[model samples]
Target: MTNISRSNYDPEVEESEYDRLERRWTEQLSELRVTQAGTQIMMGFLLTLSFQPSFETISLFERNLYLSLVITATLATVLAIAPVSFHRILFGHPGAKARVVSITQVLLRLTLILVALVLSGTVALIFNMVLGTTAGIIGGICAVVTITTIWIALPMTVLRKLR
Candidate 1:
């Protein structure tokens, strides 16, 4: 894909608002492709966990945690992937790009939530199996902190500073 340079953007040039939005959204779709691929790989791994022998040895709480993680991962996959599928279905259709991008934004936010949940659950499950509830609690807290630091706090701080 060719990168859109600052020269390509001219605020003074008049275009239909819809067309402008579509162009911006198409750019966003390109940016999100890498994020979609990473999430899909993680989701694929989570999906296959139920078939493992260790899964049977997991406690009821741990099993529930795993199930929740799987569900979250599935949702995350769907959300992360929606943009590509949306673009494919709506290609060449007038007024589709803006709508696709709008839906994708919502889905991307949902994907973040699911990703955090899956990460927390996975951490808890591993600790639960190896060292019981106390360790699981500590691991869960660590996971939450990690997600918050990387996904929420750092991004918010950087975005705010940029603004």
Candidate 2:
């Protein structure tokens, strides 16, 4: 069998640790794309609610709740999309790893919050339109609980285990 030279196999122009971080950031951006799409769609739908015929018929409290959820969705969409643009602007900076990691953590938190808001909003909206106060409250609670479990609890548990 022919043997390869170590220097040839592992080139002198090897990637620095920062290049590894940049690669990881690229991967993280790809993953965030899916979440960005979903939240943007949800925010779009939330925006259209004001023009709907039924929107005027809802109680003041429900209207306020709907508005709050829409704001959350909008914020979430922005946060989710921040990292991509942030990297583009800060690509060559020496502090890329620190910035990227900070942005990633913030995006994750925003995503979880947005997930809860969107889920609760959708559920509460449906119940408000169909089954009224009791059902809306119940549905919102259920949605929050689900988000906390899958988004917050599960990730925290896995991270804790890793540590």
Candidate 3:
């Protein structure tokens, strides 16, 4: 057996630029799969809510909030799946994978933002219907803060530490 020098040896395998881009694309697609599932479920829930008999009893503000959430959820669903369309369109072209991956990253961020909004708004709407307006607003704020902390702040902190 040949002995490998520890200082000269890279434990991590080096990937070519093309291979790196492909790996990034694959990872992005995996993330999209998770995001898409949740977005589609939320979209379906929002779509069916309007068909429910109790939906008619909602206050005007609640109705408006529900409508906004439905729109936001729909947007999130679209954004979550948009990367696939982009990849398909850009397929087989030289250097297109990089572009596809970049676009996917942007779309993923936007999708997450819209999903966060839908979640917070849904919570607020439910609280308003069950409790009161103040409670609803508070619930929405709390949801926003929690999501921001977990999704954005934590990532930023980790990145800073790495740097």
Off by over 4 Å in 3: 1-13
| RMSD after Cα superposition, model 3 | 3.4
Superposed model 2: Cα runs more than 4 Å off: 1-16, 156-163
TM-score of each: 0.78, 0.78, 0.90
Model 1, residue 156: displacement in angstroms? 1.5
State the C-alpha lDDT per candidate.
Answer: 0.80, 0.79, 0.91
Error of 3 at 15 (Å): 2.1
Q: lDDT ranking from best to worst?
A: 3, 1, 2
- Off-target runs (Cα >4 Å) in candidate 1 are 1-23
Candidate 1: tens digits of C-alpha lDDT, residues 4-94? 5675656535668776786778667765786677678877877787888887877888878888887778888888888889889998898
Using TM-score, give the best candidate's number.
3
lDDT of 2 at 109: 69
lDDT of 2 at 81: 85
Between prediction 1 and prediction 3, the one with superior lDDT is 3
Cand. 3 Cα-lDDT: 0.91
Give the per-residue Cα lDDT of candidate 1 at 18. 75
Q: Which residue pairs clash in candidate 3? A: none
Greater TM-score among 1 and 3 belongs to 3
